[model samples]
Target: MTGHSAVGWVDIVVILGYLLTTVYLGWLGYQRTRTGADYLVGGRSVHPIIMAVSYGATFISTAAIVGFGGVAGLFGMSLLWLTFLNIGVGILLAFTLLGEPTRRLGHHLGAHTFPELLGARYQSKGIQIFAGLLIFVFMPLYSAAVMTGGAVFAATQFDVDFEVALLVFALITAAYVIPGGLKAVMYTDTFQGLIMILAMAYLLLFAYTSLGGVSAAHQYLTGMADLVPAPLQAMGHQGWTAMPKFGWGATGYDLWWTVITAIILGVGIGVVAQPQLVVRFMTVRSRRELDRAVPIGAVFILFMTGTPFAVGSLSNAWFAQHGPLLKGQVVKEIDAERGHALVGLMKETSPGRWEPVINPKTNQPATAPMVVVAHQPAQDGQGAPVDLVSGRAPTVVYAKGDADQIIPTFINTALPRWFGLVFFLALLAAAMSTMSSQFHTIGTAAGRDLYERITGKHGTEPSVLAMRIAIVIGLLVSVSISYNVREEYVIARFTAIFFGLCAATFLPAYVGGLFWRRATRVGALASMTVGMLVSLFWLLLVKAKEASAIGLVQLVTGGKTSLLADYPNWPSVDPIIIALPLAMLTLILVSAVTKPSDPQHLRRCFPQYAAPQATTL
Candidate 1:
């Protein structure tokens, strides 16, 4: 197999044309904007289709397609469970159970942001301020993850520097979001969602067809169970077509815990509390619109998440059949500074195709390929590297297959050149749609929720201007993180961190405020604070993946990867598993004892229920 070339002039022209169209749509949204409400929530009059597509687009970003899709490449089709949860929980349950109440509450209280909704319901400015700070501070980590996914693919497809791609991507998104606000964000999201559907549908069809259909692909992938990397097998990997070994109180349950607790439940449940997604509930004028949107959003999520997972897993079979083989000698060197062994030798002749490096002076391939594998430390801290394929000490690693690069490599090498241009645009759309919403949410959290509440200045124009400025600041923060964060396969990890944090901190309080009339201001505040603190404590001290990446645990413990490193399977458990239940328990216990909110405020928030009860009496 040969390498894919950098995008050609025709591709460049098509991309520029797409950008111009997006600019025109942004201008249309800007023309429609009139007041603070218009800027924050599209004047609460968005069409059902537009609202649904915007919600799905905001929910499914490059993080889903590139990040988690790459994860699917490493882990297997077991990721399909996440796609099921995305539709069942994220779309159906969210829209049916929570959407109407949130919309009614936001409308009745005149709340434009998620923090404002919580603050207004609880009648506590402190809650608003704290939530706003949380969002402004941590959301950048997730934004940077999304930005990294887009920049990685762009860098691969266009053959540009990753930093250059990230900067350009951020600037392009800021151009539309700062001025057009929610209106432009939704309009552009609708357009982008359409592109995503088309691209994913094509990719899914092509993957199965190229692999001799569904059964053939799965059968072949199942047959390659022996090809599972030795290290992965040691960690309980069964095969690409089957679930990881599942058990508790044992060492080999690491993969099972990671898959269930971190990947599936963390992201699946966390989507319900995402500020950007919740705000979309308030975009439409009525509950009827939400009902109309349910099916559209469900179908959109299915294509958005399902296609990527399926295609990502199928790529393993495609690569095994057609990918370039490594032919080289083994060489290993220990790097003392990073504490990892540099092993293997190979060179990329194209995006996904690897071969021996060519000697420029001699115009011939090197006698031995020098493949630079990602840094993976020995389990014993001995600085000995294991071969990815054979799981042997001090052997040649064949391919530079980072989990983050799997989807991009497959797209570039396995698909047709024309499809590359289409997928690039689709990925750009995925990144831009989500980034615009994120920047918008972060700005509102800073300007409308934090700054206005702090200064006691509620004028519409001032709030709008402050939000625009905050959007630029947020962009800078996310861009800087994207440029500087050096963790490998970080897209999925950072995404899970943000999502799990939001769920643990905000989900209990937000749900309580909507349904439990007796939920007190103190209870909401306490639940949020405890949830945030516990989640952070767990991430920095106990969760092995995040703890090691953060290095805070190592710094405090003098080289321990986690506080519970010796405890079996504890380090692999997601923070959400521990923190969310505690947070909910706190909310329930505290609310049961504290004074209930004012009856009149509850009446206004739940007017539909209030009238029914009043009539019955």
Candidate 2:
């Protein structure tokens, strides 16, 4: 039997059984659902554990697994620090600080979408409309990011065609989501969350031990001190020991800003304003349920994010050791030749076919490098062994032709075939877990924001059916975007860009509406509008350039003039830095300029947790 399929049929049955059971429960949940509230918000009766898992699934995805992890492997461990903040800033502070108020406002105002809540709170439909517009525009991009992550992992690991893989995953999500709505989504997310956490934990421990045990792996990493640069060396970045040096690019300012400040805060802080996530706050039976959810959410994040960060940081240095020659001139050449040589180096270092090195120091029981190679036909009795150091000719080419397909490639090679199957299934769970939730949220917003608002409808069996249909449409749109995303665009980039946009646009209105009584209707509109435009403008208008004697654009983009011709070098700060304050001030100034909205009109403006049991200005 080829090593890839070594697991007996039992593993397949167990994994598929798990999937079927979860899907069935989701369907059961759909059956029990009776109203728009139930379909959209689980009738606002969700348990804390369920909500916690759902939150975890929503936050983490293949982006965390492959996209971010891949980059961490390329860069260094400082990236992992973002995970710490994900829990502290994104989840913890969000839940403790924002959850109650957001939920209260949603209930107080009898709102559903973030827009609806904000509009009703501030006594302005315009706010709701603007909010809806922001979400409708930006959410799809977020979905595309998740899809990008899935594609990268698929292409690298299972060797599936990128488009094909994208469609498969997207369609699968659409199918389940379209039928079941949020109930199906939450149910599946609960299951998928468990699988993701388990998979990451298992993979980390297994890989750590398999690579010649933990102690040896540490020594191997520490011994390769020469691989890191002097600046990096000073900061403890010994390829495996510590963080990367602070700089402009690479493990520099961009990463810190994007990951810790922008993406993390945008995601974590922005949760208060996320129509999809905010609605989840309404799902629970009571504030007590929300309170319960906090700890579970924290633990889930600790598991999901912590494992990936750990693996990503340590594995990055590990891959580098077996990766391309750590040379400046060679590293800058962006050609198929560089890719080929790297691939060769990767192939040669591959232990156990293409598994990760078990131990760098001893090389005893050394596993394959974490890169997958096409299994060519056997020559004689021996399968092709990796040649780890295939420098082209006179210049050590370092395998002369390999790749950095560490995540997927390693998964395919290292585990027993059955375990590989389990790993893939688990990965699917991770993808679907979040994808389902996104589908549910988009549908709910459509139903509540567009359909409910347009139709003036509330709870009903038919409305639930309408929400189901909206789910179908939302799934279709998200999947389509995913299908179209280019292979070059990574998961982290896509997700971060959209999320950054959100932080820039929404955070202003959300926070201001809550705290700034001066926020006027026009102010809310302006804030949302300006924030969105400013964020997008930064990315589109600004151009990034490297320092060069000639010109950065020519040096990097290979043009006679400059790189900005193709694309501008935006600072890539999570637009929140500029957009948030501007949006807030816009809301305040606009409100102050306009007549005060009738105080009687205020009832619909705040959340349930805010100032009202009955809700009047």
Candidate 3:
């Protein structure tokens, strides 16, 4: 069989079983869900274990696996720090500092959605409507990015069309989420999370075993430091083994900033304020459930996030050892044209062919270069061998430059077929879990939060129907976006952009509302407005991706500049680094000058403050 063969019947049966089970559980959840509360927050009765797995499953999606996995393949093991930050900041600190209070406040205030919580806390309809609008408008970008990650991986690995892959995912997620609501979403997530945990564990072990164990892999990769591309080296990539040096000095500042600020800090800090994740805190019964959820969430994050980064980086070493040899015809061509300017030196000179390489140390060409060619075997009797060879191409592999293809290629070429099928299922789970949550969140913001706030209606029936409609609309928008932004790198960056915007726009006000009684309505509104705008401006004008995509930067600068066009060039920096502090400062400064929030309101918001204090004994 060819290396890129379709999955076997055994694999197809396994995948079909997974889908049927997910749909069946979703139907069960739908049967139990009757009220808006049950639909939006799982009636706030979800178990701690289920809540933890659901949160982690929603948090780490195709974006983490297929998107950032590609980044790990390019940038190396530095991505592991992101995994640590995810566990430490995203889970541990997020639960300790934010979870319990969010639950209490959400319950006390009768806030099922994030915007409802903000609106009720600040006593402003404007804030509530605006918050909901921000989510409805910007969240599709993130959903699209995640969709692209999974679609691309499926297309590359399975030989399926990308459009078909996207359609299947959208349909499957909508099937469960629209009818079953958050309860169904959680149930499906729990199952998906189990698959992810198992898939990642097996993949990590397979990676190590294929590379002759962990230490040998590291040693081999370190020795191949010379193979680090010139462009990457110029940008301060020392090797895959070491951390990139920080700051704008002899070491490349661009690499440092991209790794540290754009990825690590952006995703890490952003997780605390993520509306989807924050709402997960409100899903469980009490502080005890949330407390129970912490360690499971941590371990799940460790496996799902850490495994991919390690596996992706180590794939580089595996390719170095087992990749293809040069074809004889191409080697002859290179020899014949040795003194002339070589065209497509590294590229295939002919289809399914490549040239010989000169010995790097000796600077001399080798004779009898290894190449795979079809030849007839000697017949023992009157019988003759078949005219063609149809087995796998053992020496036809090459280093893949497309970062998005790295993990998918490795799975297909370096692992057993059953393992490939299992990993594909895991990726499908990642995508569906995340997209379901995102679609549900978007729907809630639009239908329950915005529609009710705008219409001044409190009917439960219409609100639920509106939310279901919004889910359909959200899926359509996200699919359109996924089609438009097809490049994996760009899709991955959009994920970061959404995270950065969330941090900038929501983190300061959300945190302050929980802690500081002095925070004012005007302060919260201003922080949200300024933070979101600044983050968008940075992405659409200052950063190259959206700037080039929109061309606004070119028009404003008369084709000569951008917001950062004349500024010193450094690593790609996430807007969160600049916008988050500014948002906090705006909140604090505005609150300091404005009238204090109503004492009654403050008392209502902070239940702990309302509790009678014991007199000193």
Candidate 4:
């Protein structure tokens, strides 16, 4: 309630104008779309700049800006490693090493979707159907993550109900995607990407300027190490400007493992196998187009990802200096039942009576006061208890201080009134661009790869119509999941889960088919199956965070959080670390033992290897 502020008429007009222009572009794409190819791959003639921007925009979603940015708020500047990987692995290697081959193979096989490309390379309907089903089923989790990030910002910005914001956001994105397909998605993505670049640039400049330049801001953040919550410190948090403790803390390398394995590597390497992003390579006409796109894509990613991470880490400095103050008293009394000290923050208006502290900004009772309860009363680490008699401390509390709302709270409270509107538009663009691509990919997976292949209906008209209907169904599933998924840092967690799953399931087989002539259909199939099952098994029974949230282990085992809860660091390890290696080994062993692919098929897939050799007479 304290952060709520009504939008001005000017803001409303600008939002309406942007929405109208987006709708017009979608209509234009609909008018131009004439074939299934156009709907799925934009006729394979998209401009390099547009394609690059679309790929970058789709790759960097609200999940990046809001969800992972929030994670940066807790984990600090260590998240910047992900940005490095985004440029190196996601753009450089992806466009050069993998992009050209994926484009050529997709064209050679006349494939439009990612699953179709892999299926054609292996020449197996089972592979195609399995890949399609995998995508259509689990992709909703990612779609929901992106949607939740957008809705969280929207709800914070407009003071509207979260359900309403989510529903409207989904509808607006579907209006453009279902009718216009990939063409509309790319066309609108170009515009959205530009907006994101501008807004993020402004935010970066503003955050640094407001905090007294880069060095001073970092110094301030580093100096506030003691401000890290006790719970976080025990888990390995060192400070806002430094990485978490390396090997062990109270929980035995739990934070270190989660950061390196689950967050950094899980999403960093996972981008290579993302079905939504891989399909972008097939949208361009030639390798030259892909070549031209590499730098543009790299620069786009650098700004898109780098800005949020820097700003998210620096927000603690700004909040500590300018955030609201809380007035309360720290009470420590012995509990009769437990015979231990009970410490809490309370406000007393009359002697022998206490009430909840009311925030002056909102005139509402504060939910989470800036107090850490322990067996003994909390201390400020300076050897003095935290003002036990008159607990008046300058505290930063923004809407429960939830990680998902950190960026939103900063935008709304720390910046000028007008910039809030601008940032909101940027977030809207981010959410829509990513959601459009996701919905489009899932639609093609269900309609073209699964339904058409299974039912033997390959006609253009029915395929296009089926894709349109499938988009609607996919949206419904995503929205339902978004509504039901309520957890702290849900966006970041779900994004990592989906990315890890894709990397484990698809990376081994996709790379093998493209680069290795000996990769057989059976090998690819076996790898995909093993990768997917192994990843799921790890998520449901091994990884502590996911397994505990899902409650599957708890239900099956009658109260265990994970299968390996007794182990030191196994529960914290990501599925990608465990499953990706096993998957690669499976592909190699199976392909080596099994018969190689047909010579003719290998010739078509690897043309350079098949080039006729000149013999000397």
- Which candidate leads in lDDT? 1
Clashes of each: 4, 56, 1, 0
Once all C-alphas are superposed, what RMSD does model 2 give against the true structure? 7.9
Candidate 2 per-residue lDDT, tens place, 1-617, comes to 11232344676587569767876877787786666566666777677898888877877787677666655554455565667777786677777877777777667666656667777866666666666655665677677767666655554444445677677777677767776766777888888888787787788887577657778776765665554433334433445455433454333344444445544565555544556666677677667777788888888887776666556556644444343222111221123432322222223233445333221111222223322121221111233333433443321122211112345545654455556666676667777777777767666666666676667775534366666677777767776776654433246666666666766677777777666666766777787888888766555433231112225445545653433343221343455666767766777777778876556555445333246358578
Tens digits of per-residue lDDT, candidate 3, 393-413, equal 332211323456567757766
Per-residue accuracy of model 1 over 454-571 as CA lDDT, tens digit each: 9999864547999999988998999989888856668899999999999999999999999988899999999998899999999999999889988999998899999999998999
Q: What's the CA RMSD of model 1 in angstroms? A: 6.6
Candidates' TM-scores? 0.89, 0.78, 0.88, 0.89
**What clash pairs does model 3 have?**
254-571
Candidate 1: where are CA atoms >4 Å away?
324-400, 460-462, 611-617
lDDT, candidate 4, at 132: 98
lDDT of 4 by residue, 517-582 (tens): 888999999999999999999999989889999999998878988998877778988999999999
Please give the TM-score that candidate 2 achieves against the real structure: 0.78
Question: What is candidate 2's CA lDDT for residue 190?
Answer: 88
Whole-model alpha-carbon lDDT for candidate 3: 0.78
